[model samples]
Target: MEEFNWLQLLNPEFYILLELGGVKIGLFVVLFIVFAETGLLAGFFLPGDSLLFLAGIYSEGLMNQFSTHNDFLNVTIFALLVSLMGILGNMTSYWFGAKSGGYLYSRQDSFFYKKKYLYQSKEFFEKYGSKAIVFARFLPVVRTFAPVIAGIVEMDKKKFMLYNILGSLLWSFSMIFSGHYLHAFFLNEFGVDLKHYIEYIVIIIVLFTTVPVLWKILKKQAHIEE
Candidate 1:
């Protein structure tokens, strides 16, 4: 009998997404995270971008562990599955909004349900219209809430579906494939394994995703000062 390493589970690098691969349940974990992050308001704080990228990097090792060959094909399949998860998650969020958004309108502000946040999403949807769906995929909190706002406003379902699919494909494919290729590039060109530097890579990805939000806020403040 062996003692369980609880500390390993607590380590940031030991992300559940990576751990799932070891247990041969990576696909299920990835899909569930994607769905929760996009579909459930409570999931707003999930590390979506970093998780997806890490998944791509670890996926190759996972496949090899299972005696799989043809890295390209495996990675392609993985990317597609992640994309579908994102698309389905947004659709689920939209449906929930359509069914229950009315309740939110009458409710007062609370820790989780802030009228200001909803209003901000509404303003974003109005300013960008359908394009917001595609653009929001690149933004953090906005990505999670854009579909909900669209549903609340009753945007045309047909148009919403088109943008939702496009956004999900763009977001998921970009993150996952970039991780896959970059891992290979580092190993081949620099003779360094990506796993050794994954923490720094995750930090970079976090900053990349968050800089836009910070810039927007700074710009808004500057305008207010003017």
Candidate 2:
């Protein structure tokens, strides 16, 4: 049997094609991926922002496969569902942290578990408080661990929920809808089909979001050495 290439699953292009092909299973796959990325510690490596954006771009294709009419309403509904999935994923993460965070924190780092990630997440949560949940949504690794940190810190549930909902809505709507509309604008204005540029676009988006986090880490390390 051939080994399953988990790396291929991380590529947004894989999900983009599935979504564009109107594979009904694509919807569930996308939702499951979003949920696991935010909710599971093992999911830190999964693509989040890029997948959302690509889903937006190919949303019309997915809709057209199901509905006879192409309209903005379908896109809006799809974005809403995606946003809700993100929120639920964070909520699940929060619950897991609330349940087992202390036990995990007490253990030594192992091959599969790194205590440093939790420490970094703890510092981020302490520095930003409830706002970290919102800001982390735009960040890559931080977003995956922020909810767990919040739970570990025993942040108020009601407050966490408020920020979680706000962050998920903003992150999901902005990425997905922007991709959907931007694809339309580029095609209509410059007669350029954005699909051909999806790989480049995804790279740019990943770098745009990731560079700030790297810079902050570097600056903090430098300050520590000083």
Candidate 3:
């Protein structure tokens, strides 16, 4: 057996190929991955933005597996389904937080858990109130834990649902459409296949979403040392 190359984490296309292998699972894997990342703590490490972007790029083909539709319509449908999963995922995390949030805070950190993330999410929730749900959707690790904090705090169910839907829809649609349109724009306008450049795009996205949290953590650690 070969040692796993951690570099593959940068490319979400790998999972779509490695796990589903283009098996016509269509939206199944996309929805599942979205749900897992937002809904399940273990899914924090799984690809999120990139997967949605890749889905956008390949939205037509992915959707064709189930039902045929116009290109834009196909991407729209894909985005909607992805949004649904994201919403559900957030709800799951919220429920877990409501049920076991106290336990989570006291639980020791391990390979699968990080209390700092939970705390950071708590900060965001405190600062932004309910809006953190929408704002955190754009952040990587924070997105996973924000709703959990909300649950732990016992935010109103109706309020959580409202922001969850709005956030999920905005996040999924923006990412997917950006990929879809950009992929098409490059190909149709410049004879470029955007998939060839997806790795770099994913890198940009990771940095874009991950930087602030990293900065905050580093800054907080520095403050503690001082």
Candidate 4:
């Protein structure tokens, strides 16, 4: 159980160990994870938001533990690299979607395919056209299927790629960098532990995004109900 618990903090642990062991090693792991999650469809489940957030928090810890110069500079570089990886990763997914097209989505039995999400993704593509790619990026489960649906529907490759990359960057980078900067600011200002608030911070961000979208949806619902 202890080993299991420790394993969950693997990225943070790696970051710390790498900083102590060598900066190059630490940076590489971070980049790899970022790219994998953003690009690989199978990697959609990986903890991208949390990893970036933790990376930001860990940056502060690394500064205190080591007499490192330019902590902010280092953190910013880390953030940018991860953000770029995220963009690149989703692009790969988009191309995969383009390449796979209808053939990939035809298999209902594939483990990654879920009836509910596929249906929803279908509805989204039918309703929103190119914008669904953008909107779906912020959704947890839906984001996974959005690209797949785009591929299945044979959405224009150039347009889908543009929106897919934009959405990926906006969603992944914004959450991560926000968490990092917030952690840095709060710690500097209050000298209190912000770790306890991580869940709330994430929830707040999810709601901050989801609520307004929901409101618009509800409003549309009520109009139809009338």
Using all chains and alpha carbons, the TM-scores for the candidates as numbered come to: 0.84, 0.89, 0.91, 0.67
Total colliding residue pairs, candidate 1: 0
lDDT of each: 0.77, 0.82, 0.85, 0.62
- Compose the digit string of candidate 4's lDDT tens values, residues 102-142: 65546675554455555655676678889888887676545
Lowest-sum lDDT 10-residue window in model 3? 17-26
Q: Name the regions of candidate 4 deviating beyond 4 angstroms.
A: 5-30, 60-72, 108-115, 196-226
Model 3 over residues 1-226: C-alpha lDDT tens digits?
Answer: 3466888765688655553442666467678889998688855588888788888888876777665557767778888888999999999999999999599889999977888788888988999999999999888888989999999999999999999999999999999999999988999999999888877888888888788879988998999999
lDDT of 2 by residue, 146-218 (tens): 9998887788999999999999899988988998999999999999999999879889989998898789889
**Candidate 1 lDDT over residue span 113-168, tens digit each:** 56655666677789899999998888777788888888888989999999999999
Error of 1 at 223 (Å): 3.2
> What are the per-model numbers of colliding residue pairs?
0, 0, 0, 3
Error of 4 at 173 (Å): 3.3
Give RMSD to native, each candidate: 3.4, 3.0, 2.4, 5.2
State, as a TM-score between 0 and 1, how close model 4 is to the true structure.
0.67
- Clash pairs, candidate 4, are 38-89, 38-90, 39-89
Q: Of the candidates numbered 1 and 2, which has the greater lDDT value?
A: 2
